[model samples]
Target chain A: MERTGAAAIIIGNEVLTAKVKDENGPHLIQRLRELGIPLRSVETILDDVDAIVDAVARARRRARYVFTSGGIGPTHDDVTVRAVALALGRSVVRLPEMVSALHARAGDTPVTAEGLRLADAPEGAVLLAQPGMWFPVLTVDDIYLLPGVPQLFRLQLETVLARLSGTPVHLVSLFFTLGESALAAVLDRVALDMPHVAIGSYPVFDASLDYRVKVTVEAQERSQVDEAVGRLLGALPTDSLVRRE
Target chain B: MERTGAAAIIIGNEVLTAKVKDENGPHLIQRLRELGIPLRSVETILDDVDAIVDAVARARRRARYVFTSGGIGPTHDDVTVRAVALALGRSVVRLPEMVSALHARAGDTPVTAEGLRLADAPEGAVLLAQPGMWFPVLTVDDIYLLPGVPQLFRLQLETVLARLSGTPVHLVSLFFTLGESALAAVLDRVALDMPHVAIGSYPVFDASLDYRVKVTVEAQERSQVDEAVGRLLGALPTDSLVRRE
Candidate 1:
């Protein structure tokens, strides 16, 4: 079966302003890759309604699954749910199950109006229940609304990953001491020859690092990735090959 | 002076696949903020031509300046320049000055066709030369094409930043032990009252962290930020205020 394409939308003003370093995008990228979902793009947008709506709509059109991080809390800045609802032409309604979960989590503390807002989701959205989860994961159509908090986002993503499967990509990396310019021609030739595989060359400038050029060969098929890596290694000058791992 | 909006397109397959952690986005975000240019969005896209072209077109339409990092090298995956040129209805051309610089850097080594390809830039693109720079930074219209290498990208960005300036934003942060839900109502009231100041509340869940809710007040004017912070402190419960910084 063909692997499904995925895209992510990271919504927050703090992230766009450099006030907060985004941990969600990196985390999702790693996790989604592990789950075999090929993430096509990640867009870090502001907390504005129009931006969120536009990003979500575009991401939905581009990929099979859209994961959104942040802007789902009770705070005024949290507008992901409203934006997604507006974008999909759906109304935001309070989910009774989520309200009960929020009340239970509060224990003796009264659930304030702001806290109850956490229960709101797009109309006809599904609540994903998981073991030991305080709040149920909310999904509207193909978009998954995840908490901005890194821990919560990871927890909810793991549950989502459990239900989804795709063709696992195989990657083979070859490191070289030569600069990318020196290997560019060979890489281009190999890329042209093997259109089935994705070949990438990255120049690492860190003096402390061992390699200068890190070439990666990737494909859904392990044999194709391995063959491409072999060809890349053979094409490189023997002296320039640092290590193949 | 009004702060100009900026957007970034991070073009690379390595970043999207989690094979490489992106250093450019955060680096640019902080640098752009310090330069008083507010970054509106950052889209990490694949090395595909259509993706790069589409992202660049969208970013150009959205912001005053559009910055693209990566896909400027000589390798096959380096398609950013071509994409930008096609998107803007221009053609790519080899830059003689860049070729000379590359030859100089190579010293005794012969400049290969691949190495010379680095000299290619979008039609009518200006090469911004800076002191002690080996390569001139490429700029087409308001779009800056930067390298993927972290050190080189930083160097190029510094040169670009020196030529640009805008109204710097002032930020005041207040920490509280109370959850965001507890402060939501007060935050909404403060946000409504202070239209100029951008108020944001972030919930930090780490037990090791001293504060739960981090409220940020930002504005172009320092006085407005200060005033909003004062009003926010006054509205919050005394016991909930963990620390104000």
Candidate 2:
């Protein structure tokens, strides 16, 4: 693995049980893609420490970067901070910097007796500090810890993503009406020929548009992506109906 | 492995890419549970045939009964049926019985060349037939393929789920405030004591409320589930509050 991108490990029971709509996975996926990093897998599991530790260990081994959302809050189910420590075979201890950051944050709101605990991080973690923001991220061993709240998940990711960004998104999206079965051979050819550009297919249905297919090609440069996608579309049934719009 | 119940596989690029909110997984999870089947796992993937085939194959092997949602529509991205056939090493062809059924259902609606192709399925597959309101389910090796559209997905499921009935959901959830660090030993002991009941933990955060933990236990009977949950909660930290209306 030459370190091209990241994968997400979403640890939360609320998502699996349907109590909360999982926003972390998608939000991170989109942002990571825009930053030119492919999100490999989004695994949602219970808030169990062993499971979290196992997931973290797996992610650390595979992805160039690994980000986790949820379970890092001040409340009881919030065991991500501890679980991460256990995963790294380290002790959970307070980071003085994050504690001061929280004190400055706990200004207007009545920070609960246990709220201060949120500031603590696993020992030797790098703090992606946000004094005003509700959620804070602590990065250790390539894993960035984030809050599950959609708002916090987004804010922290923005601040953190800026620091570890790779390539910028560049590609052309072609939406047309076609069946994949009839075009599988052509797709296989394109995939074989264009190794640099990534092609993804998405099928969508709407009342007005009974059936539509969106083929997106992402690459390091716009010309490379566009040229590869152009070649693939040329082998299709009809190029006229295949609108680049 | 004797099939305990049916499993649901979520197929879509939108879901894997996190572009769209996935309703299929939760919907099928509830429907299958009501039908007395325990859902094994919900796997989301990009609109790639190989990926779809691999996931479908895995699901089919793990659970005697497998239901796939998404990837069976009228667009280029709709490759679920083809993928299933490929995974089974079968060929995709139009089923006359299904074609007639679809023709009758699309009575007033204009049937495009692509629309008629919706009747295609793997050879020798039984039709999980829906009188007129839903897409037909094609079964290959005990795997039932369903549509991705929520409305049609629900209609198609009703016909198949009705075949397997009388499985009541004996699961109760208790949300409380307690950190895992303080009660890891108690949870470990409970896991050993209760061999039958399923235990899971979820962490949730709300704007107005402090983050908390929700623990769920699933069993064959309500009493079994309740007793197990009670015993587990008792071992947790005292003075912790649980979720209430």
Q: Which one is best on DockQ? A: 1
Each predicted complex: what DockQ?
0.75, 0.18
What is the lDDT of every predicted structure here? 0.88, 0.69
Best model number under TM-score: 1
- Superposition error at A16 for model 1 (Å): 2.0
**Per-residue error (Å), model 1, residue B119:** 1.6
Which portions of model 2 show Cα errors greater than 4 Å? A1-3, A47-62, A71-127, A133-136, A149-152, A175-207, A210-218, A228-244, B1-8, B33-36, B48-64, B70-127, B130-135, B147-152, B170-220, B224-245
Give the alpha carbon lDDT tens digit for every residue of A183-229 in model 2.
44565568677877766655555548744666677778889887887
Q: What is the alpha-carbon interface RMSD for each candidate?
A: 1.7, 6.3
Interface RMSD of 1: 1.7
Show where candidate 1 strays beyond 4 Å: A1-3, A107-109, A205-212, A233-236, B1-3, B107-109, B207-210
Worst 10 residues of 2 chain B by lDDT: B179-188
Chain B TM-score list for all models:
0.90, 0.80
The TM-score, computed over Cα atoms with residue i paired to residue i, of candidate 2 is 0.68
